[model samples]
Target: MENNRYNNFWRRLAPSVGLFFLAPLVGEYLLGNISIKDIWALPFLAPMYGGGALLIREVTRRAGRGWPTLILLGIAYGLLEAGLIDQSLFNPSFEDHVLQDVAYIPALGVSAYNALAFIVGHAVWSIGTPIAIIETLVPARRTTPWLGKVGLLVTAVMYIAGSVFVFRDLQREEQFLASTPQLIVVSTMAVALIGISFAVGRKPQPKIDRQTPNPWIVGTLSFVISSLFFGATENWVGVAFKLLLLALMTAVIIRWSRCQGWGIPHRLALAGGALMTYAWGGFVLTILLGRSETIHLVGNAIFAFGAIVLLIIAARKTHDM
Candidate 1:
């Protein structure tokens, strides 16, 4: 029985696992190894790739028994590539190539290895955590989180060991790191928010009753908090929004963490909260959290697209669920 169930598990896993790594793999196959131009493909596809599954779920819900919407999602996947890509860095000159070859990669001197490590690590955690939660929450074929936990824990342990290498290179990376105060503030806040997310991962939360949203105070606060993000735009508001979003996420996280108890589908909301938190973290970190003027240049492309995609999915799901 166990062996048969394990076979069924692999059946479900195969497609998603393919979809997950397949995005990057296909990009490389067509283009060649990751390059500055090709890798810019990272930010755009990263969100959609994972969100694609949810996107499929949403479209199917709306279409009501049809593969047509699923086909549409495939086309939209191209829009993700069409959206924006900065290929300026492909300078693969002697110096750039040398730097990469010498056990290094960097986003402004912080270490390329470190950034890649984080991306790969997050890719693993964010992708699996949601599916595991869904497995447990879905009305049928639910799997225990302990099964998920054991896998996640083993992978996390390996990632951490590699992170030790990053810590050692932190100082070496400092030379390429931003010297500006704003960038420092933003990156610091980003690290903190990610840390909180690490703690919140995949733990089932108590559902916030959708019908009785206690929106009285919390909803108002959510709106206010969201507006703070908007206002920060006009006035160099990186740090403020970063902190506010974190606080907001933290609050909702506590409420939703009891989803198993509340009988509400908090994943939609928690996904919203997670998206909000990580989206802001990515924004803040873009130019060292809030320092570099270059942020505006790349900002709208990555964050805006991800937000629009997320908000659309969230609104539709909330209405349906």
Candidate 2:
């Protein structure tokens, strides 16, 4: 009985924990900011990031879908974060991000580059990475809902409350976009994205001739490509070029996966590859950017290394499975 209770406790808590850390790990720490130094931030961050991931993962899995659906939900989460909650998508100047005129749509007040990068960043790193790692860690539970209806309701409330807090804070910084029409359009699009995800996720994926690649190769390519992509964000030209490369690689992967050789290992490898980019790059950029103190930088580096090791282990386990 005690064992069952302990198991239930961990089961109840692990998903939240995984999601809480993952948001900062991938979104803040790995991407650039070492918000780990700010203990005061976790309360708000936890609800916003953790709740978003948990809700999406549970909803998609409960719907009997897989990564593709999760990816769609991820895109929705991205839109929510960048568009509604933080309004970074519409912010003319966010964090020294000079995206106002980079393919800016005057009517929409949206920058094509910023929208794409932010959305993809949240989709791939913030949402996708954690889900892949957690699912890989416990493959048996991959398809199950981690939260019940009550739990989900609580999570949704927490997420909304967190968003309100963030939106208020952003407004204080004068970074808030107050366009109601834009808000309506983006919110409608977010809803549409979620609907599309559920609709597509309900369909069965077609069987194909799987051509699985070496997990290491997949990880390496993902690392190199994703690293280049992240690095290119420094300039508009690089961003455009890398976006093209990203599209090309994605197309190739999808086509290749249609073959029978594609399996669990390949999927994990692809995830690991994307994650490895941030793992190593996080350390180097943290130092170069001087975003944190020496101690914080060193601590973040250690964590990054640990993450890479764990991801590698997970990749191996996924391959073996």
Candidate 3:
């Protein structure tokens, strides 16, 4: 009985912990920042990124929403982090970033290009990708809520506390952008986006007679589209083009999903495409890290290969289902 109880405790805790690692591990460490190597940072980061991911996932799932609604919420999360917490979008010299002026708007006091890329990064890679990968790993719990009411309250508190902590840290590193008016505007917009997601939650998918495409095709398209999204944010014009591309791709996916035979395979493919970006980007970004050059690059390459294999296996399993 003790053993069974122990196992149940672990079962209940696993999702939150798994999600916690996903944010720092994949989003920060694997992506290039090596600070996550410090054990002390885990306490702080786990609540920030991990807590945010859990909050987004739980809120959407508990509300009975599907992937689309979850993605929208994830977008809101991204905006909140970039716009409010870090203010990277509005900071002209954020961390002395390379493209600080890429799409600088003097009047609005924001980088249009960076704003779009960062928000999309958090939405798809940081939040959505981890949720998909973790759910794939635990297929039995894929559609189910991972926490009860008490657990949710705890997670929310952690998230809010982490957000305040990050805001203070970022405040010291750089002077904040445009302050009150911008804060109010972005906050309002983020809330509105979240409201929209809830409003459209879990509606029944439309039906059609068209056959679903091959999983490989879906994955490849996802990879290509996502790559475009990642690379196309150097300037205002590119930002505009990328937005149009995103809208078109979204429309295509919605239309295709409504057709006959769409299922887990297609869904996994779309997710795999986005996941692949991180895999390869991990390898490329290793060069920019500026230390242990060959070794870091090789490690990133290995991680990328392993991720591809895992994704392939997941695709196969989805196909069987």
Model number with the top TM-score: 3
Name the regions of candidate 3 deviating beyond 4 angstroms. Answer: 33-43, 175-178, 288-292, 316-320
Cα lDDT, model 2, residue 54: 81
Screening candidate 3 with a backbone cut-off below 3 angstroms (N, C-alpha, C), the clashing residue pairs are none
lDDT of 3 by residue, 18-104 (tens): 887777566665565543234357678778788888888888888888888888988898889988988887777777665467877
lDDT of each: 0.37, 0.76, 0.78
Superposed on all Cα atoms, the candidates' RMSDs to the truth, in angstroms, are 14.2, 2.5, 2.4
Better-scoring candidate (lDDT), 1 or 3:
3
Using all chains and alpha carbons, the TM-scores for the candidates as numbered come to 0.36, 0.88, 0.90
Considering summed lDDT, which 10 consecutive residues are worst modelled in model 3?
Answer: 31-40
Off by over 4 Å in 1: 1-143, 146-153, 175-211, 214-223, 226-267, 273-303, 310-321
Better of 1 and 2 by lDDT: 2
Alpha-carbon lDDT of model 3: 0.78
Instruction: Please give the lDDT score for candidate 1.
Output: 0.37
